[model samples]
Target: MSWEESYHGRLRAMAGDEEVLIMVGARCLLRDDQGRLLLIRRSDNGLWACPAGGLELGDSIRECAVREAWEETGLTPTELAPIAILSGADTVGTNQWGHTYQFHITVFLATAWTGELVTETDETTDAGWFHPDQLPSPRTANVEKSLALLAEYDRTGVFVAP
Candidate 1:
């Protein structure tokens, strides 16, 4: 379905133009065969970010994450393990469209996926894999923190929040 016909879009249409919406979304963190993290350059914001989107009605959060990963990165994350669940007043942000949102997102680490990789998409302009210590510039504000969560997970084998 078109984004405007999706659940959040319908909800946003009902809310005031300036209202801050509480949106539930999910991020897919994928690794290439060489173990680099995957990031997408968001078309709307021109910032590098993990493939993500708001959850739709009649879909679980994991479904939302996998679906968004497929749409934005052209790969279906086959095996995902939730590594972090983040949400707070601090999570609020205004998009390029000036729509404000407080994001509740689950960050998923994918162990396997299917399909050939494609960078260009409706939501993303580019995609690439980066080593943990060598991320590209002009990335999303939360990239470091998210990576830190992943690092913690690697060291401790525990999710950031659960």
Candidate 2:
């Protein structure tokens, strides 16, 4: 089972379905040598997003970022630098199983990586690299925010919060 299913299942069993759960996760803004950004089309929502997922037990945020990127996009991150920490009521959502969750998502920039890009059939339907100016339409809110932060980071060497 995935981390979400395992954790949500355990929580539901312990606290009942009405309890709101807080999930910590990480996302990687993977860039190729040519400076193209990597994006994955999620199987569940059919929306393009950065490679990301909830932290599994015993995994650090950096490890989570690396693992999620590899799992979803077949890339092995060699270096990761944190870019932003996004949280708040706006990050709250419900899964397909009707379990409510609040997310604390740490966004990371992978400075170096290597792998053949292939989408994980279970999680993503497609994966590709795109120039920032030519990004796919209708990206997730977090992805849009990450892209903005990435630009700001590139320009100023620091991520400025909005």
How many backbone clashes can be found in candidate 1?
A: 0
Worst 10 residues of 1 by lDDT: 141-150
TM-score of each: 0.94, 0.86
Candidate 1 per-residue lDDT, tens place, 15-36, comes to: 9679999999898889777979
Number of backbone clashes in candidate 2: 0
lDDT of each: 0.89, 0.84
Clashing pairs for model 1 are none
Q: Which ten residues in a row have the lowest lDDT in candidate 2?
A: 1-10
Model 2 residue 154 CA deviation (Å) reads 1.9
RMSD of 2: 2.2
Q: Write the per-residue lDDT of candidate 2 for residues 1-162, one digit (tens) a residue.
A: 664476545666787666789989898999877889999999888889999988877889999999889999888899889877888998888877677889898889997888888966579999888998898866777777888888888889875544
Report the lDDT of model 2 for residue 130: 93
